[model samples]
Target chain A: MLSIKNLHASVEGKEILKGINLEIKAGEVHAIMGPNGSGKSTLSQVLAGNDAFEVTSGSVTMNGENLLEKETEERARDGVFLAFQYPVEIPGVSNLQFMRTSVNAMRHHRGESEMNAAEFMKLAREVSKQVDLDPAFLKRGVNEGFSGGEKKRNEIMQALMLQPKLAILDETDSGLDIDALKVVSDGVNALRAEDRAILMVTHYQRLLDHIVPDFVHVLADGKIVKSGGRELALELEDRGYAWLGIKDDETAANSAN
Target chain B: MTTANKEVNELIKREYEHGFVTDIEVDTFEPGLSEDVITRLSEIKKEPQFMLEWRLKAYRRWLEMEEPDWAHLGYDRIDYNSVSYYSAPKRKEDMPQSLDEVDPELLKTYEKLGIPLHEHAKLAGVAVDAVFDSVSVATTFKEPLAKAGVIFCSISEAVRDYPELVQKYLGTVVPHTDNFFAGLNAAVFSDGTFVYVPKGVRCPMELSTYFRINAANTGQFERTLIIADEGSYVSYLEGCTAPMRDENQLHAAVVELVALDNAEIKYSTVQNWYPGDENGKGGIYNFVTKRAACIGKNSKVSWTQVETGSAITWKYPSCILRGEGSVGEFYSVALTHNHQQADTGTKMIHLGKNTTSTIISKGISAGKSSNVYRGLVKFGPRAEGARNFTECDSLLIGDQCGAHTFPYIESLNKSAIVEHEATTSKVSDEQMFLCRQRGIDMERAVSMIVNGFCKDVFKELPMEFAVEAGKLLEVSLEGSVG
Candidate 1:
């Protein structure tokens, strides 16, 4: 469902993602684990079409369409969703209104009529139950004054509502408590299907314990140095990333090779 | 990315949409400022002798007054001799009693302004009085408003029919010599809307005035007066858009509002005068004075504005809380882009005990534009236990633009409490990224954030005006976000 070849990206002229090559098929879940500044967040931002980062080399495609050429909204409409690490606080726009607008924009892009207010409210109510988010929260400004756990749940609720083909969870478990993590993982697990893919980016293997990955790739500096099964995350958790003995430059060179 | 670039490219080629002058015939007065022009304007309106003398007095006062240079705006000197003081659409000898009898071309002009004379066909329940150049083109929903004992008509007609009312409240809030523009407007003002809500009656519809300037080399000096009697309530809206002209056109307007015992008045404005081109060569010098007075116990008055146009705009819509327990509020969102300059805010005065006032102002500046917020809150000696709260925030889209806030608070009553807060920040790249990562594009994201920032003020606007104000912000910031 997704492919990245030699993806080299940078922000403000500083290289972040160097030669990241990865592929994920439908129904597959992948976990990319790395230390801080290992280009994990950069990878998610680049995939979501953030303009601040310049893709110096390579390409990304989703379902055989050129994702790099699309605007951020177009990319989302094409079924790519990114759960941001820190959700934005839009002070006066209610969560329901934001969700409705996003859904309508995506639906419009997909050549579908917009959902009316009644239909949208019905859908929102049903999804709110599944995500265990308070229905009252939908009427509040998007993430304004919301606690850390509420924001995470709201992000998951948005992903569940959109039902994207590919979901990128960028450290969705960072600030969540144990119960919040369980609920978020449960929401993600419910959406797993034969035609959808999930990419979980995390620092600790604890989140992987809830939403198990089919494959795990270790990213160092800006390049992926190791690819293995779920056991790879457990191995890295037991032993630090130094177990690889390969420096970041070596990994870049190796990826180039 | 492509959408942002497209908007930027569009801004690069932005042209004034309503810059053409229709070839309609007009009865025009000679250019230049003099007692003769004032006398001619008053006589043309067939005003009472007292009004004529009043205009002559204001004209003499304006002659002695110098144009205000204190506002944080820069503009070339206005050539008073090059502007026609009075230019009205040529009306028939008999006034039109119904919309059908109005001139078709005049109706077309109002239609182009989105203010058709059919109330049922209009959106958002806006009963409009369309003023083209200097004369009222059509007034809608007159029958329904008349049934409610609400008198809405052209100021010229009101002076003839309801002379007592007009004489009682004409300059009650903002006097003729309040400012240079107010004095000028009082001197040669041609025509504007007059609204009176009778005692104990709540106006059933939103009263709006759509002012358009289509005559060449003509200055539009419109004077508006709205009075809500005891136990009455009313909401009034004013919107202005001028056809583009290469030479700067002067528009000096004065608006006065009065709220009596237990009355509430809400006034909103969405000013979209023709902003100059990127080089800032020519546009409207919109100098306006708007003020409301709370004259009786427990009276309330609120002013809300969404200003997005004009090359140089200088206005301060203020409130005088004279009654005990009266309240005054001002909410403003002023945006300037592409060489526009606006110096606007409000003034609140507390005279009686336990009066309160609140002011919230948000300024957005982009593309070398300058926006300033200057406000004053004053408490008199008898204003015991009076309170005031003010918050002013500015968002700069680019480094080239500027935003400033100047607030003055004075209290002579020892028991009064006043607090003010202000902040200045740019639409940081990080905020944009947060929105983009959620699949929102840059321009929409910027607009969303900006709307959120000004939501407080937007909510204070009438429903229709709120929607128009939102769209205006989008259009004003078309190429602003990078």
Candidate 2:
């Protein structure tokens, strides 16, 4: 469903993603684990068309369509969803309103009719229940004064609403607790569809223990140094980057020893 | 990103939609201001002699008064002599006796302004009094209004037919000697709406006035007086959509509202005057004074205004809570794009025991515009247990614009409590990215954020006007996204 060839991206003229390549077909889930500054988040941002990172020498395609040529919103409408590491706070804009507008925009792009407020509300309420988010929070400002777990659930709620073809989760599990992790995992497992793909970028195997990936790729220094199945995550958690000849902190290696 | 910002800014430079001149012959006073000019204007309207004397008194007082320079505004001193004080669409006979007798051209102009005068068909529950350059053309549903013991007519008609009521209420809230703009408006004011709801009577329909300044080189000085008697209720709307083109920039107007015992008055204004060209060459200078007096115990008055146009706007819609346990509320959303400057807020004066007031103001500045909120909350010596709550928020769209807040609080009563909260925020790029990434366009995203910022004030507007205000904000925010 998604393809990246020699993805070289940078921020502020500093190279972040250096000549990286990845491919995932429909109904597949891929996990990219990396140390700090290893371009895990940058990959998600660049694929979602965030302009802050310039794609200097890369070509990305979604369903055989050139994705790099589209704007951020256009890419979103084309079914590329990026769950931001830190979801932004838009004060005064109700979550329901923001979601409704997004849903309508995507529906319009797909040549489908726009859903009325009542119909959309019904769907949103059901989805919020699935995510364990209070329906009352839907009426509040988008991520305004929301707790870390609530913001994560809100981003997951949006992913569920959009039903994107390729969902990119950028450290969505960073601030979630055990209970929140379970709820978030349940929501993601529900999105395991026959025609959709998931790319979760995380720093630990804790998230993989719930929503286990079909394939795991350890990204070090912007390139995939190792690729394997779900057990690769456990190995990384056990041995850390030092086992792969990459130096991070001594804590993970010392603990492994 | 640069290209996107360019497109956004281009949309922000939207042409003034109602800048086309209405081609109609008008009976106009030569460009000047004097006692002779006031007399001639009064005589033209067939005003009572006492009314003329009142205007003369105001004129003399205006001569002694120097224009106040305290407001945070920048504009060249107005050339009063260069502006024609009066310009009415010429009629072959006396002012139209009914809607049928009104000129078709004038009606067309009002229709273009979205206030149909030929019939009360479009606006089913709202009765509108359409005011052209310097006089009222037609007031719809006058008979129905009169049936309810509610007198809704042009101020000129009220002066002639209901002189006692007009004499009693005019300038009672905002006295002619109150300030520089009020004095000038009292002396040279040509025409405005007048409402008098009798005791125990609730106005049947929404009363409204649409003020349009069509003629070139003529200043539209409007005087509006509303009096709600004991146990009465009324909601009045003014200045819908665009105020059309005004070659003559000065628009000094006064509006006074009075609510008696147990009476309630709600006033809403959607002011879309011309803000001039992109270069800020020619636009209307809107200097208006609007105040309401809660004169009797338990009276309530609320002012909700959405001001989006004007080159330089100096307005302060205030309330004097003189009645015991009286209440006053003000909700305003003032947006200035391009070179527009608006320094508008409200004054809440607590004089009665247990009186309370709430003020919420939202200011949005874009394209190098300057928007300021200057509000005053005062409590008198006898105002025991009186309280005031105020919130002023400013949103800047682009880097070029600016927003400011000037809040003054004075309390003589030790028992009084006043709370003030102010915030200054920008239409940040992160906010924009969040919205755009959700598949909304730039315009829709900007408007959404801005509308959320102004949700508090917009809720106070009438239902239909609330919708219009949202669209107006969307249209006004073009090019501010950068």
Error (Å) of candidate 2 at residue B296 is 0.9
DockQ of all predictions against the true structure, Cα-based: 0.40, 0.63
lDDT of 1 by residue, B1-482 (tens): 33333333344334555566667888988788888777778878888998998888888888889987888988878877888988877867636788877877877776777777754566456688888888887888888899999999988889999999999888777787788888888888888999999999999999989989888889998989999999999998998888877778889999999999999999999988888787787788889998989998999999999998889889888989999999999999999888889999999999989999999999998778899999999999999999999999998776677898989888899999999999887676656655665556667877887887789899999886799899888877776765
Query: Candidate 1, residues A1-257: lDDT per residue as tens digits?
Result: 89999999999889999999999999999999887789999999899887778999999999899899987777887888999888877777788878887888788777899999999999999998887888999999989899999998898999998999999999999888899999999999987989999999997788999999999999988999999999998887665666876343432433322
Candidate 1 all-Cα RMSD: 4.0
Residue clash pairs of candidate 2? B8-B479, B9-B479, B12-B478
Interface RMSD of each: 3.8, 2.0
Question: How many collisions per candidate?
Answer: 1, 3
Compute the DockQ of candidate 1.
Answer: 0.40
Instruction: Give the candidate number with the greatest lDDT.
Output: 2
Candidate closest to the true structure, highest DockQ: 2
| Docking level for model 2 | medium
User: Which 10-residue window of candidate 2 chain B scores lowest in summed lDDT?
Assistant: B240-249
